[model samples]
Target: MPKALSEHETEAFRERICDCAARLYVEEGPAAVTMRRIATDLGCGTMTPYRYYPNKESIMTAVRTRGMHRFSQVLEDALGSPGDGRTRSRAVRDAYIAFARANTATYRLMFEYPEPHKDDTAYREAHERMLRTVVAHVDVMIDEGRIQADAPIFGHQIWAALHGAVMLEIAGMLPPGFDAASLHTRTVTALIDSARPPAP
Candidate 1:
């Protein structure tokens, strides 16, 4: 009989499976992400992937959950960096764009892909963690009197703007010489300025 995989080996293999699944889903859409396809891509037996993941949906959930946690960490690191509110806000914005560009496929999976199991605990918690990171940054600005707006509302607005810019860049929809970074910077700065209290 074959020796069982060590716990670390098991986790490594799971990550490999998720990486393969994410690429297939991004490149060919959900229809292409079958268990057989994943196994074939990994050069394993057809049933090998099934041993690790019960179904395609579970694999996709794992992929998305992993992506969200990684994304949240990037944002959290930027938020936690030593800086004033405006500086830290820009850091988070830059980190958001950087992550999207670097992990376009995973980014799409996290936001663009339809989640049939939206209530899945891991995915939902990761989603909420990301949301809280954004709102917490906004709260920092508000506490410093940098802006006066509802944390959740302003957080959503900022998130919407950044996501729109990133999506356009990802889709190659932005016109020539108009990059997502510049657009993001300008839009976020304008939003922050708009929320500022009037000068006495």
Candidate 2:
């Protein structure tokens, strides 16, 4: 018979499953992650994960949410790091690139990998928060007269440029023999510089 879990233990087990899912998802994409696999890793019954996550998508959402939360924290830490707004912005970009490189799977899920869902409240919110952070950075630049203020979502435009470069590099869409790391930095610098086009 399976051992019954107390209320505290049940909650702890649920959290454990979530944590394990995140770790596994980071190590491997969602395609390779399954309830049975998680249960095997947890040494629990195959049905145990169902008790916590109704489906694989549920686990994917939870793992994706967890990764976004971590991303937000990384942005916060990078923004607060040494130097002025420009320097701090670069730090945030560096943190973002480092995080992607370190957690390739999470980065894939965040940008390259895609998920299907009807109601993606958490995912939407996390994406919005990420854009807001970018907008805030551009706001700083605008205050310093680095970028024009008239353009809407000027910051997100910068973000889109960054995402495009990073995604291309990760998706192996870069030039036949281009330096990804240097190209990534160059693209970011150029985007920020371009966002400051002369006012009409």
TM-score, model 2 to reference: 0.72
Deviation in Å, model 2, residue 11 alpha carbon: 8.7
Question: Which candidate should be chosen as best, given TM-score against the real structure?
Answer: 1
Candidate 1's C-alpha runs over 4 A off are none
Local lDDT at 22 for model 2 = 63
Model 2, 185: alpha-carbon shift in Å?
2.7
Report clashes for each candidate as comma-separated counts: 0, 0
Model 2, global lDDT: 0.71
Error of 2 at 33 (Å): 3.7
Candidate 2: which stretches are off by over 4 Å?
1-31, 42-44, 118-120, 149-152, 168-181, 197-200
TM-scores, all candidates, are: 0.93, 0.72
Query: Against the correct fold, how does model 1 do in TM-score?
Result: 0.93
Model 1 Cα shift for residue 157 (angstroms): 0.7
All-Cα superposition RMSD per candidate: 1.5, 4.3
Error of 2 at 150 (Å): 5.3
